[model samples]
Target: MTKEANAAYDSSWTFIFAWLLLGISLLISGVRDLYDPAASAWTTWLGFISSAVFLLMAVNGMRLRRRRRESAEPAGAAS
Candidate 1:
């Protein structure tokens, strides 16, 4: 990989991991809220929805990384 592409790939991984982390935390919060006496139903729903969105973002990032890697490869390298 070129220097710039390598840098971008590394940064993309960083973002992907960040998204995954956020998703996990939010999912845990949502589940916890479900069992907490004082937690509002709306708060729980919001946490779950937000977690789904973040997890989707992480999945998209992974797809983008695959595309980037494929494009970076030489034309004849695939077969």
Candidate 2:
């Protein structure tokens, strides 16, 4: 791949990684808050849901990107 294409690929993965990290952090925080007596029930559930959304986004992004790359590859070379 050309340098530009390689860079873009790396950047896309980086973005996905960032989202994954964000989701993990949110999930951890939500779990932690779940055990805290002072934590609000609504906010904890919100954080949990938000984390699920971010994680889903990251996974979907990775799947879509991989599909695109595979489709762009030559049929024989795809092996």
Candidate 3:
């Protein structure tokens, strides 16, 4: 693939990875909470916040990918 294609592919993969990481973190936090409901509450909250950050990163990555694709297109193309 060309450089632009590679960049797009990488961005897409990054978004997927961010989502996967967030999901895994949440899952672990949930399991921990189940094992120690009271003590693990803080841990769960931290995990939730981390997941939110990852979600935001994924959204930003998607936006960057979209911008890259738009810039790669010809100027005469419709918006």
In the order shown, the candidates' Cα RMSDs to the true structure are 4.6, 4.9, 2.6
lDDT of 1 by residue, 10-48 (tens): 656756766666566667666766788366555556656
lDDT (10s digit) by residue, model 2, range 3-55: 54664566577667666665665676667676884665656566566656655
Candidate 2 residue pairs that clash: none
The local lDDT score (0 to 100) that residue 25 gets in candidate 1 is 60
Best-fitting candidate, scored by lDDT:
3
* Residue 60 shift from truth in candidate 1, angstroms: 1.0
Order by lDDT, highest first: 3, 1, 2
User: lDDT tens string, model 3, 1-79?
Assistant: 9866776677677667667766776787788878887776776677677767766765776677678888878999965
Candidate lDDT (C-alpha), each: 0.66, 0.65, 0.72
What TM-score does structure 1 among the candidates reach?
0.53
Question: Each model's TM-score?
Answer: 0.53, 0.54, 0.63
**Model 3, poorest ten-residue lDDT window?**
3-12
Judged by whole-model lDDT over C-alpha atoms, candidate 1 comes out at 0.66
Clashes of each: 0, 0, 0
